[model samples]
Target chain A: MKTLETTLRSLRESGRKALVPYVVAGATPDWTHHVEAAVLGGADAVEIGIPFSDPMMDGVVIQEAGLRALERGTTFESICQELESLETEIPLVAMTYYNIFLHYGLRRTAGRLHDVGVSGAIVPDLSLEESDEWRAASGDSDIATIFLVAPSTSRTRMRTVAGLSQGFLYASARMAVTGAASDQGEGERVVSELRRVSDIPTYVGIGVSTPAQAHTTAVFSDGVIVGSALVKIILQGASPTDVESFVRSFRTALD
Target chain B: MDEINAMGQPDHRGHFGGFGGRFVPEALMPACVELEEAFRDAWSDEEFVALYHRTLREFAGRPTPVTPLPRLSQRLGLRIFAKREDLAHTGSHKINNVIGQTLLTQRMGKTRVIAETGAGQHGVATATAAARLGLGCTVFMGEVDTKRQELNVFRMELLGATVVPVTSGSKTLKDAVNEAMREWVTCVADTHYCLGSVMGPHPFPWMVREFQRVIGAEAAWQLKELGVDVPDAVVACVGGGSNAAGVFAGFAETAAQLYGVEAAGGAAVTSGSPGVLHGMRSLILQDEFGQVEEAHSISAGLDYPGIGPEHAHLADTGRATYVAVGDDEVIGAMRLLSESEGIIPALETAHAVAWMVREAGGRLPTGSTVLLNLSGRGDKDVAQVRAMLMEES
Candidate 1:
């Protein structure tokens, strides 16, 4: 199996930008269907968010979806159980708060994700200083610990995170939380900053809401991640087929 | 263990034994690093120290006298002295920390401050500090708490602060913190997150406690001056444990046995396990699946599911004893303090009083000399208490 970093690197080497969509696990009874929808809609990877009670890094849309998922009895075990039936070959990444993994036992969580075909993890609240343990645990399972570099990250810190990151470095396009409505971001500058220090694949996210926004950010970075815009569709009762078209639109815009 | 003996300041990287560390998003790393550097520099400079002292003395009305609660002491047979933080400006120990943070904000060239509040005491204090420093202030409060603490909302507005009602999650103090953190990400360039407690990532837990250390320092001196060198026990209520940590800093190395009282429904030290929340790894009320559990208390200020990281370490190391008190007992204790000593302690502080009430003759022993940190006034809780009393009657 190709590693997450190699897969993204190969995709970028072939001049194809990566497309990833984020979906909250158990937000709906058929939330897994949405991940499959994004997979079939031409996404290179799918990011699954296990519901946590307090998501300090998330904005309104993701928070609402997480709460909805929690009300539906979502848990790490349930999310992994759901992922077992996903039936997708695309790379999968798990996005969540640090406590979810910390409480579940870091090594056990990493092994569990690997068992469920998850190739990477994105824990936003876990800083680089506190990530050595999780990084080692994930490495034991050959799971990539993807790291984020924000617009406000210092020059020295940017290089360290880029080097420590196992998968592609996530470039948060703005100094804002996920699902914020505005499209104004510092994607170009941040991506260039990462490019100057490391030769890894970088994806710009956080404010990439519209297809035009995705098209614009993809011009500078290796890929673009769409979260709140797609999650909004899922939260408002959009069917799997509807989500498929939504992901396809961004895929088309990027291509 | 040795560092903990010196009042538990986290190491250079902010690890308090095994509890506290910086766990925040990448967006805020630079700000945390910058703030840590700024704080280190300002804290050691004699000029900065002088300015901090002058502000506390003149603006916050510091050196709040230690009051002898004679009537209550006689009734309980435990000679008690109350460190009257209720007399401080803004009516709480919260003002001391805010004044220091707002001053530090100006020093860092930040022109605005943002904070999260549960019952509004911290919000009011933050607003007051910002007003004094001519800085813009915004406070995020849970929508549920805003309804429960309407007067506090109005009070913050009166202090010229914009109060945003957070509606996500359980819509309480936890959600308010989430909102404040989200807001800080966007505006970190010019705004300082004047955290209301000794919680959150890194510098915040250590920095907030350093600022709040005034409570212990003042009470220690006053006690010595009053010819009591060291009390038998020193106690305070714990929410995020700021005031408890503050008062404990003075007596941690002394002969005084340190005690922290927590609301039964919100007792992180008593009922919680180590888990990460609001950026710090601390004792938190969480489900088996690692999801944070909602905390319930009559006082919104104490209605939190987690305690400060240092408190968790202290509990783990057995440096202090922590116990829980119920809402019913807290209410009774509130009335007792008010009627007996003509002092209306905030329901948050009444947890300590309630714990003493239950243990005075048993665990605490009769005639034991005790120093209590009366962390806040109850004026803001008057309406809530009245409504609750009426509902009960």
Candidate 2:
């Protein structure tokens, strides 16, 4: 399977914007199928989230989805195993916190993630200064360590993060978590600033829910990450087909 | 004088029982090492010690009395004692560590102290320290925690500290820590990371414990004066393990059985194994491949994936026995303590009181004494406690 870095580079070269879909592991009994369905629906990458008990940054929709996933006994290892069993070669990224990664030794986690065909990880809780262990452990393991840039990120820090980050920069659309409204103009300005400072491809996430929002973000960035909106679709009683159909709509919107 | 470990030799590489070590990125290593050296040098200096004691006595209201809980003792069938840290400045033991760290930050020529808080106790305490020392202070807290701890945010702001509401992942204490750590990395030149507990990487666990050791040290002196050479047991709740570590450190060489009670939502020691968490090696509730599992105690303070490195070391070395208490137990104990002792402990501390009641089985000998470190008062938890009580009723 191609790594996230390789896939991102390929996408950038091909003039093709990336499509990353986030799925809460075990949100339902058939969450595995949903992941497979997202892949089939033309997702360029998949971000699997391990549900937490007190998810402070998540909105009501994402929090509820996480709770439902946790209720179904979804665990970090279980999700990794699930990803390993998949036959598809789509690049996988785990979006989680430092605590989870810390609970798992960085080297061991990097190895296990590599074994399961994961190409990258985006730990929202890990600082660049605190990421050395992870970076070193994952250096030879073929997993890209992704970092985030917020609207409030300073230029110097942005450059530093961009320099350290592999794969792509997870540019937050606003100062809030997923499922919130995007400050379109502010997001654009931050994206432009980040583009000027960063050498890596940047993808805007955290509140781009609609086709128009995705297309709007695509104009300035290499990709747009849609999480809460997609999760909301599933949570709002949408069927798997509906989710795939919605994702296709987003893919077309970006294209 | 007894041979004191002056160079802090035991803290080499900052491992307290394979629990505390600087497992962070190389970028953060230099800063951590510098801070460790500064803390050691400052703490060892007689002048610094004098100033620390002065601040504790005048500003923080130190030497919090060891109150005999007659009603609680009578009800529990054991002589129960309370080390009233809640009476300290800002109403919690959090200030004890914050004051010491803030002073160290100033001595290190740092302009700012950045911290993460859950119940806002630490934030308020940090703000107090910043105001007293006239330094810039910034605190990162989860959005949800900010809402629950709104008054605390205002209080921090009132004290001239900027309370940045972290809107990222599960915006609680853990996420707040993430944001603070991130800020610290970027602003390491001018900032000091004021960790609230005895958790996190090497020097943090050791330093915070050293500052908080006053709790245990005073308790020991007081307990001896109260005609007890050694208590049968000492109990304290384990969030990031500061209070418990402070009290436990006093009884480490003694025969007193030390009980470190963890929130049962996801007990790091009981339900987890040795792993890296928050840039330290400690017992963590993690997956098979070592991803930290989310913790879920009713007490926000105890809802952490890992314990302090020293606590992990203590647990491993069998110096301290670790136990777990559930939400219901903690809440029940909260009411029991309030009703019996007229002291409402922070829900985090209630975990320890709850364990004593449950594990004691009403069989503690009448003469057997138990010293429970009442880490903090329950003012911050009144609303939540009331809601829980109303629900139960």
Best lDDT goes to which candidate? 1
Best by TM-score: 1
Per-residue lDDT of model 2, residues B1-393, tens digit only: 112231122457776755567655333555777898998899889999889989999999999999999888877788888999999999888999999999999999998999999878899999999999999999999998899878999999999999999876667777787677656755787899999998877688888988888898899999999988999999999989898878877777788888889999869889988866677768877666444567898888888888888777778777788989888788889999999878999998899999889866343455679999999999989998888789978
DockQ of each: 0.94, 0.10
**Per-residue accuracy of model 1 over A22-93 as CA lDDT, tens digit each:** 999999999999999999899999999988999999988999999999998989999999899889988999
Q: Please provide, for model 1 over B8-80, each residue's C-alpha lDDT reduced to its tens digit, 9 standing for 90 to 100.
A: 6688879889999999999988899999999989998889988998999998888899999999999898989
Point out where model 2 deviates above 4 Å: A1-255, B1-11, B287-291, B361-364
> Which pairs clash inside model 1?
none
lDDT of each residue in A1-255, candidate 2, tens digit only: 126777798888898888898888778776767777788877888888777554434666777888787667777788888877777777888877566666566788888898988888887656675567788888778889898877666777778888888999888776555675845735787788887876688898888888888898899899988899888877776777877888888889877
**Docking quality tier of model 1:** high
How many pairs collide in each candidate, listed in order? Answer: 0, 11
Q: Which window of 10 residues has the lowest lDDT sum in candidate 1 chain B?
A: B1-10
Kindly report which residue stretches of model 1 are placed more than 4 angstroms away from their true locations once superposed. A180-184, B1-4
